[model samples]
Target chain A: MPNAQRKTSKYVDGRWSIVSSQRPKAIRALLGVLFLALSWVGAQSPAEITKQVQANLEKSPWEATVSGKAQLPDGSSQDVEFRLQVLPGKEQVARVEFKKPGSLEGNFVVISEKEVWNYLFLTNQLIIQPRAKANVQGLGVNLTSLGDFDQLNEQVSLKLLGEERTAEGAAWKLSGTPKDKTQGYSSMEILVLKADPRPLALTLKDAGGKTVADLAFKGFKRVNLTAKQLKKYPADAEVVRK
Target chain B: MMPNVVHGVPNAKRKAQDAKRRTVWVVRPASYAVRQTLNAPSLGARGEAAGGEGWGGVFHHGPRATGHRPRAFCFWLPAIGHRLSAIGDFRGGIFALVVAVVAHVLATSQAQSLTVGLFAAPGYISPTLEGSLELGGFSLSARLKRDSLGLGVEDDLEFGPAGRFVFGARGDLGFGLQPLAWGAEAYLRGSVAQFGLDARLGYASAPRAALWAGERNFSGFAGNFNASYRLDPANTLRASLAYAGDVPGAIFQGSTLGLEGSWALREGGATYLAGLGFRVGAYALLGWRGELGEEGTLLDATLRLGWVNRLELGLFQEELRLRLMTTFPLGGVPFEAAASLEAESLRGDVAYDNANGRWTVWLRYTFTFD
Candidate 1:
């Protein structure tokens, strides 16, 4: 009777221990499910975020000194700085000054949905052209111009390649080709912030596999701009009026 | 006459001696027997009868009996003269006839060798056919190329199609010596209704740099030199150097230098050749001129394998092109016709670009005439 009781007690202790170990695993699995559910809710559509950012830009009035470096076609590079401002119900204005690589020194103006005015400091002339369009022979299609989120999504088939963390923070990679054959930018990949979906970098490659242009956007604000800044154009700017 | 003088012969004997001394001439009768026996034409009957058997007998008998001086020189002189004269006349006639026949043959042959044809290409695929004639040392060829640059700016807006055509001509002159040959060719190339002409000159060494030049008025001056060496009975090595530049005051200007070598493998029913070449300089000078600093380089290589009488396959990879081509001959007249198909990179970039590729197909026929 003594041996039997002893064996029974040991078996009970073993059972309790097994129950205790299994309980922790169950709790950990529950926590993992909770985390996954939170992540799914936080994820946002790229198109939705893009539209919201553009709307915010339209209403922003701000001025800031922004500097960046860009890789040029010949394997050389260009660094540029600009003072920017945006006004409500008016064109956004920027005074871009190019520096470094003594060869290029110039100023350009980007008007909201209207035109670009480039000033050649050496030639003392301003070339103005209409903002890029979706047609092949024209400038090019700008994704930011898509006003409706659903329309933008349908027009551009976006493939999310992956996610990456950069100096600014985590960003989502989206790559796609033009659904319409006639569109100017045939294939492109853009990095946008997962939080705000603002475009961080954009690479535009031509049909020939040559990188036609690359643009990086940084520094954001929401405020009202002024009339003086809108009217001001750079002296010695050659206007390539298109 | 001397024997008669010694005996104080009579007047008749002296007369006979004198007659004998005089050159005796005999005339033959115009008889069927004589004509048949001697195979000679008969003299007149009257003359033969007047100079009777006495004269003929005296002439023949005296000459033999007296051991008289025979007129051997006189007999042979007429025969030798006649034979020489006949031979000279025959030779002159034969030489004249030979020259006349040769000249006539050349003129007639030249007329039978002329040919001409035209060809066209549709869409972005430019197809061309050309025919030429070769006679004496000269050859003339004409060719045309047409292609469509689909969906232009206005075409895209209006949904239309547009294209262009180019036409050209080339002439060549060739000459040769034992185991050594040379040729020179000039060509004028331009669009049918366009404002430009590309003229070129090419020269060659036997089995090998033929030099080249282009017209000064059209675009540029160019030169090329090539050499080929036989490594063995069935193998050869070739080398080339070339240069080109725009003429003064032309709208565009540039220069290029290139070198290349090829090895030919000839065995079985197929022949294979592989080669690599590189050119360093500027090309297409008018476009993107500002972006290209001073100098650029292009490296190209090719491999070709072919069946002797039936098919050929070729691959070319370069700084500006990557292509695979296959050709199959459909044996028939004009001469044998051939069809070629190719898949090529339009941008000539080695990197894969999802944007564009080109597919090309062409058919050609070759004919020869004498």
Candidate 2:
């Protein structure tokens, strides 16, 4: 009763701090629980983050525009731009239409569950082959792999690197090491937005730490897509199947 | 057929579109073109000879001579790279074929691949070269050699992403009888978000070669401007304008203006990401047309019915123009060849306009590299 009437308190930093026995235990316990909850959210493993991103993207048929820089197998950097439309289902199909690096303009690659179709605008020709035999082009980094975290993990080992304060808020960074030593690059970096937990940018570096690709994902939208929509082409285009 | 609104849409929607389409009837009898050629003199005086060899090939032959113009047949000889040559004299086609063979045998390596092509009517043969190269993300394409009536050496340079952009230039230097004809053009193109833009400007003056000559001297500025937006992956709306050159239906050969708004769609599995657009530029000729002057109309229809884009049937007059586009890649060759019997007119009749008809068969072969 005497301490409650003359509560002891101390001033610390910018605010006054109460270090007294008069505080309610229930309120203190609630604060502790809130802190723990926040810490738990922040402590998600890198693998969990990757899984979350994959699930979020696969929730529907989505389309996004990817534009940035990529490193070629020959160790040269190319400006890369393409439109990616993914229709996820039992018979999933994804189409990537390139608009950048002028060489591959109007070209597209369609990956389905069973096979892949590659169309070259310059030749007005379409080449269809089994996915197992299809070669990864436009950069050794497969454009379609980012949507599948497990596949990407096999290509490059990923770990939670750090988080950085961004204009929108904060973002987590994932640093990855390519498992294939034969590739020109050594490591990669991905920035994921914390607000929505989606990937924002990806950067690949050569063995010397030279930047290979620095692609930023933008104009992402979740929409209903069909296989026929992804398979659109010039009616007169040449089709070749192997 | 390329649907205007049918320019692109689902099959069901395209079928419901009210657009222009046509089937060209090529009656290439010895006497048929002779009758069409009889009216050539008046057309040439009107400067319509600039069209050179589409209604019947009267202009493709030098000095406006007309007698026993044997209907020409084109032969396909695959060369290394991509190039399109125009209207042929069979002998010239034969010569180009031999040259193409020699070029293929000599330069089939990653070093230097050559493109050889020939197009023939009864009196003229035009050959051309189109080739491309890709290094990293940088790409450069060039179409060298021009027929008497064809555009010469269109060069396209692209460096992109980081921001997508393309710079292209096409021009010609002609050593002809008149003041040595010359033309130059530069264009810029970019795609961002859902919008796309392309603009081009150029100037030209005629060499005045008789049929071998350019009749109309486009001595002033010519340009084409286009803007497009994608409503989605399946639908696109585009608006284009061509000044002092791309007259509608190409009714005026010299320089006229054209403005068009078109919507295109994609819905078939085989037609996926293939070449589909609103305007089917030329009826008898099928392929992508870059020139604004050659924009086709609603009366023009090109039907491509095939399995996997392999077999194409042009239902426009039972292949009267012999337009065949196929990519039967044998043994994983990844090459393509096209031969079309084309007869173009200099009017806007839209009903098989053979009024000032110019006939020429065009053959194109494309070579590819990864």
Candidate 3:
């Protein structure tokens, strides 16, 4: 559930080039001096930066619509679109709806309190499963785990990978290496906007250093939801047993 | 109401008040549900104290203060009557049966929710309708499923409070219209949490194509026990053992044990531009056919890929059997189209070697309304 996205096969590791090439020689020297001064003033630790990102997520209830593509090992790619609505409270609820592909258009999943309700619109089948089975790995952006610093730390090691300006804005780049090798991906890089600590993008890689997926985030905003509206999500659906 | 996102301006005061109002709306219902759970009688414990089955001992679990539950059946009588009067139209009768079950569930349910869905393939169509009602610590659920092969109605009643063990009984009636066979099944599910037991006692004589578990022309009891372990957030290990036998006859017409592990290898995502996802899994099954005194083993591997979160293709194989399945949108009102092709080939030196192939196509649509 880390704010990680699987990179498409088209992904090229540009971190080294961006760090090595983009800046002008004068600005590079000035930035080195600024870094020395900032070091003297005590820069934020990787843990602190990761926590700040988590805090930014916990600041309110928010919803985001993410769209991206996944490139398969076969070299074919699939389109992906989903809306993530996070209802924060005593029992946090995250609802995801798969859009775009006509086949999965009405597929909906709701997770709360260690349980998940997966509704397959095509079959009118609602499958109830344990929440542990609902990990949001490789999904580009994990809204449910955005505020879960403990979960992130438990699963992977975090390190600040320096900074750069993206299409969005100036940001802090961080790398995560899974503590357990069995995870979906070997490592991931995340970009967080420095101005607001908002996560902007995630790029994941395999152990061979090949790009797996790239996820970009946009349209993040808070929405006030009434209790009735929140409760209506899972409570009304009839439970179907297989 | 939160301030609308217009152009790029932030209206702070309105958003803050809207946040407060939203908080109240969510908290109230949650608190009410909690209160209701606390006030309800411990239905599971009572059922255990009185022993399972036999209503004469104690019917406490039957019909709660919600008298509307029993009254819910009133709505079904008329529809059932209509089906009985038009017995020749068995398909229509099956459709009415599903509607009645949904109506009954809605009438008795505090939430009054019903779910309906269908899956169709060349030469086959299966539609399912279900409804559930909750009263105190007890819940009643009814489901009706009909397909080209057969029709089945299952009723389940479970009792337990939240965060505790649950116990349930199920009654099932199955009709095989094609072969004109009828069957019934009774079972207990989740009777003990540590055991993860679900046992069904059944009597069936339906054709293999129309019967459950592909059991043909047999009357017997069959059930399976399942258990699972979570290796991590993304991996789950599961195993099950099953037993089936003919009634007043062979105690083991068939027995099987299977194990499966599923990993969420690569989760897919999408935005307005592009999306993709993939997962891989493998499982093994070993079984014995007592009647034929034959033993067999099956190993299966599967891979699923999604393109733009729109098209999905699944490839599966077991031993000499190979299958490919696909589901993609047809673009007309978001229609979903599915196709499956399977082939089984004989291997090893044999006097006569041959292979069999099967294929099916399906179109599906889904809708939801209060």
Best-performing candidate as measured by lDDT: 2
| Model 1 chain B lowest lDDT segment of ten | B36-45
Candidate 2 lDDT over residue span B158-208, tens digit each: 221111334545455443213344565666655443556556676655311
lDDT of 2 by residue, A11-50 (tens): 1111212422345777656655654564556565667788
What is the Å distance of residue A154 in model 1 from its true position?
Answer: 7.4
Choose 1 or 3, whichever is better by lDDT: 3
Runs of candidate 3 exceeding 4 Å displacement: A1-37, A40-42, A71-75, A133-147, A226-238, B1-370
DockQ computed for model 2 against the true two-chain complex using alpha carbons: 0.05
Better of 2 and 3 by DockQ: 2
Model 1 residue B170 lDDT? 24
Ranking by TM-score: 2, 3, 1
Q: How high is the lDDT of residue B137 in model 2? A: 36
Per-candidate clashes come to 19, 44, 30
lDDT of 1 by residue, B38-115 (tens): 000001011111111111111110011111111111122232233335454543444345335534544555422211
Q: Write the per-residue lDDT of candidate 3 for residues B307-335, one digit (tens) a residue.
A: 11122222223222221212222221112
